[model samples]
Target: MLLTDTHTHLYYETDDVKRAELVQRCKYNNIGRLFLPNVDAASVAMVYSLESSFPDLCYPMLGLHPCSVKENWEAELAAIKQAIHQHEIFAIGEIGIDLYWDKTFLAEQLQAFKQQIAWAKSLKLPIVIHCRDAFDEVYDVLLQEKGDDLRGIFHCFSGTVEQANKITDLGFYLGIGGVVTYKNAGLDKVVAQVSLNHLVLETDSPYLAPAPYRGKPNESSYLIYIAQKVAELHQTDLETVANITTENSKRIFGV
Candidate 1:
């Protein structure tokens, strides 16, 4: 039962002891691969450091997150581009529209998303998107940027069946996470509607922990619960869910 955490923020761990513990827990839970998504210049170093420390388990991605988009976003994007050249990034991601927190940077966020999408296409790498309270906005940009070259995961997807179909139709995978296990997230219904082939597993660690651990600090090891919930939703076994989503993750990250 080899599971892959398609999205995690191991860099968020500050202490060496906790980081080591997290790695051991993930190993015990059969989480063999963890994809780390970069937020911006501030997080690039730590993201790369974690990947460097666990070359076999952690793979790093480069991009500018929407929430980080501000007046000086151009400089941040430039820094991200420079970092990409310096590091062997797996993808261009954790990037997209995020209007949940603030709308002050909506225009800048849109520009950053589009530019990052262009970077992904140019580099021939998949992108892991971070869409929040901006589905229509994200979909609009994706529609404009849709093409054979655009392929990636809609990270942490918690949308409706119609939205799920639209994302899958665009050749993007839906990143299923702890939200699927929530009491009334309705992600279970979405899971039932979308084929497993169009889905991948994620934890968004230090964020959305699965039920029984929801609202608590999430970790890669907890991916088991999310996988189990997905298995239940698909009416299959846990190993089946893990295998399929692991393969789907590999297809996207090419690892």
Candidate 2:
């Protein structure tokens, strides 16, 4: 079965020479699809250019990442809107509130996030949430703004079964990543309790690679590592994990 990496940032700060080799390794590892999320206006061109060059392999999503919320966030939001109007992006994402690193612009981040969620609904696209140490704060915004139209995956989900149930009840998929394979990630309980339909596989690559590759630059090929761990936890085979996650991703991104 073909595996799909539902979340990856292959072009982020990547060297051209290594990019060539990295993609070859992905092919060898059975990864056929890679979803690239836009981080900011600065990275949008690169993300789309990568998608254009590898249309058969890379798919692009356009949205300002949560970490990118800053003083010029309004202008950045306008740029994101213009890009949405101009091109055919899969979804609005890598978007959400992040309170862990800094809370200086938490308010602005929420505003940008909800505004983008509304935009995603207007565009008839899903969202890709990037919650970190702020699930409660993020969920507050979601509870207010989310509706049948505002649906997508909670990328890099690491939460309680209750939280997982809450997200899944909203018809959003949980993005399981390298954290699942860690010895003490705490994702094991959530993965075991959540059904396959509410789950999607990802690496958030060039970032959180699974065990053995932990503490190193992640790649799409490492998606299989996370998928394999999910399979083992769910007491199924690797292909089963790949198949269900592929279907779940298609449902969310409409790819």
CA-lDDT, candidates in order? 0.92, 0.88
Q: What is the per-residue lDDT of model 1 for residues 64-119, given as tens digits with 9 covering 90 to 100?
A: 98989999999999998999999898899889999889999998999899999999
Residue 214, model 2: Cα distance from true site in angstroms: 0.8
Per-residue lDDT, model 1, residue 134, is: 95
The C-alpha TM-scores of every prediction are 0.98, 0.97
The per-residue C-alpha lDDT of model 2 at residue 115 equals 90
- Where does candidate 2 stray beyond 4 Å? none
Candidate maximizing TM-score:
1
RMSD of 1: 0.7
Candidate 2, lDDT over the whole model:
0.88
Q: Report each candidate's C-alpha RMSD, comma-separated, in the order given.
A: 0.7, 1.1
**Which lDDT tens digits does candidate 2 get at residues 88-135?**
888898899998899999999999998999889898999999999999
